[model samples]
Target: MTAVLFFLFAAAALAGALGVVLSRNPVHSALWLVLTLLSVAVFFLLQSAQLVAAVQVIVYAGAIVVLFLFVIMLLGVDREETLSDPIKLQRPAAIVLGVLMLGEVLVLAGHEWATGAQTAHGVPIHGLMDTGTDPGNNIERVARVLFTDFLWPFQLTAALLVVAVIGAIVLARRSGERPEDPGPGIPAAERARPGSGSGERPEADAETSEGTS
Candidate 1:
């Protein structure tokens, strides 16, 4: 039944989200994120919104998750960090915000259910729902509403994303300017010239002794 399928997908999404938070390795976290995104796409499918589901799967699960994995792998950030919290009151603040968001969602869901409309908690909040059409409408209607009704905000979002991308690039370049910290496998002396092999310093010492003798 649809109800059973909905619960199953919802459970999967919740589990995946928890896995993303609890997994120590960044790569594992990214995989869990893919699971969560895929489950959300399934939610769209259950609502008969095939286009949204396909976009969710392709853009989020496929491209975005792969990009996350690539960054974790390439940047050598797969290792776990210390468990100590860096910011003061961060955990308590996050818990408060999460509780507030959950309360808001519950209230909206209850309101929509009481209204008995297929609005899905006022999904297209900018305008009224098109009760005349079935749930299987394609993305054309969504696109039209986005461009016509929300064009300025959409353009602002695009500019913000562009600024974020530039900021990330600048940060990455700045980080690269600093010398890399020594890893467990690297000796303090060799960290400066990791390419010079493990015997490099000893060979230099031998050469200096021979020259003195």
Candidate 2:
């Protein structure tokens, strides 16, 4: 059962990662990234690292990805013109890096499997087997560690979130007010003036008929 779950999660993570790179639309790519993050959390859960899994879900999958989506939406990217053969070299490079990463992961997994490894508590580490006293207590232990020893990092993360929010707002805002133009009609004060050149001109007097006679 553990083997089956590990394979399933690994496949899901790979597929989601591929989708993130290959998807044309940025929104779809972001969604794919979310999926990839979720699969990673599942992998952590399978390894009995419940704390790491929770952090993966809360920080990466929840906060970071949501911020990415927010920025994407705020930018209002046009999906039609997004992936139209732009950045030709980037795609191949990304594929190569992804493949190399997958190879590294496989090698690491194999090495861990070969060794008779044990958790910090000296219990044998099986893929998905739970060897702890109470599975429910794992969350409590994680909370204690995070609040005690790791409190500084947690506070720093919160500060980073605040900065991100401010940066996003600044980036999205338009600078300065738009220029205004006077309307076609003359100004009220000018129209009120008697000889302001705005009102109708006086008619020209008729030619002096007496002088001609």
Candidate 3:
């Protein structure tokens, strides 16, 4: 059962990672990244690292990926227009790096399998240990280690979150009070007054002729 679960989680993690790399849309990439994070948490569960799994979900899948999505949306980039150019170098470079990473992972997995099979007792040394303690104790151990040993990293993560929140707010805000509308320039009284077609003009002409005679 454990072996089956391990294989399942391993496959899921690899698939999710591939999806992240292959997805062209940034939003889709972020979604695939979430999947990858979740699959990694499953891997952690298979390894009996429950605290690590919880943090994996909370810090990565929940916080980090959501922030990524927020930034992606806030940017409002037109993916089609941006990616229209052909002969781009990034795609090939990414593919090469991905292949290299996959090869490395395969090599590591093979090495671990060979080492595990060659063991005399045929028992997994790093398999789940019977800690004979409550799950709460495990949680407490994680908290203690995080606060004592990993405090700097934890605080740095908090600071990163703060920056993200501030950046999102700034990006989402409208530029300013939105310039006031400049209405029609003509006054209402001038617009309402009637224009003289011939009455005032002809009278003024006749008075000018009589005064000249």
Candidate 4:
């Protein structure tokens, strides 16, 4: 049953990952990424890592992805016209990197499987839950190392993320507020609609002048 569940989630993860890469729309790609993250959380649950699974769902899928969607919304860049690939070599480079990653994954998987098979009878693979008295040993140990040795780096990463989000918001708002050029001597308001300003519509001003006289 465990093996069956693992394979199911593994397939879902793979499909979701492929969808993320293939989807043209950024929003659709982000939704596909949620699917991939959820599948990974399920895998963590199957491994008895409940804390990791919770963080995977709550922190990544919930907070981070929602923040991503917020930035996407703010940018308002979903139009098909704006979807052109600026860098010509980006697609080819991504394909090459993806292929290399796949090769590495295959090699690691084969090595682990062979080692596990060889030790199947003599030794058992003990996970964090099995080795320690505390059921939350994996999470605790990770938190210890993260907060102790990697605390500064972790805080720096968080600060960088915050700065990036602020920068995106500022750029989006600045672009939105910028007025398009409407030729020489055109008032910004009059440019919004033809003949709607004092200078643009002289006939209306002249009529008012005659009425006043």
Best model per lDDT? 4
Residues 1-213 of candidate 4: C-alpha lDDT, one tens digit per residue: 677777899999999999887887879888999999999998887766777899999999999899788768767976444556799989889889989999988787668564565545444334335534554467787788789999999999999987775454333321213454333443455545543343434444344333432
Model 4 gets an lDDT of: 0.70
Error of 1 at 151 (Å): 3.0
lDDT of 4 at 213: 24
Higher-ranked by TM-score: 1 or 2: 1
Kindly list the per-residue Cα lDDT of model 3 for residues 1-213, writing each as its tens digit: 677777787788888888886787888888888877998887777656778888999999888898788668767862743555477787879789989999998777667464574544455524454333455555687788789999999999999987765554444433224543223442344324423232323333344323432
Error of 1 at 14 (Å): 1.2
Give per-residue lDDT, candidate 3, residue 146.
89
Report residue 17 deviation for candidate 4 (angstroms).
1.1
Maximum-TM-score candidate: 1
My TM-score estimates for the predictions, one after another, are 0.59, 0.57, 0.55, 0.57
Write model 2 residue lDDT over 3-101, tens digit each, in one string.
Answer: 787789889899999898778888888898988899999888887888788899999988888978877876688364455557778878988998999
What stretches of model 1 exceed 4 Å from their correct place?
Answer: 81-105, 111-136, 174-176, 179-213
Q: Report the error of model 2 at residue 36, Å.
A: 1.4
In every candidate, how many clashes are there? 0, 0, 0, 0
Off by over 4 Å in 3: 81-136, 147-213
User: Which pairs clash in the backbone of model 2?
Assistant: none
**Whole-model Cα lDDT of every candidate shown, in order:** 0.69, 0.67, 0.66, 0.70
Better of 3 and 4 by lDDT: 4
Over 127-168, each residue of candidate 1 has an lDDT whose tens digit, in order, gives: 122323634345776777789999999999999987765554
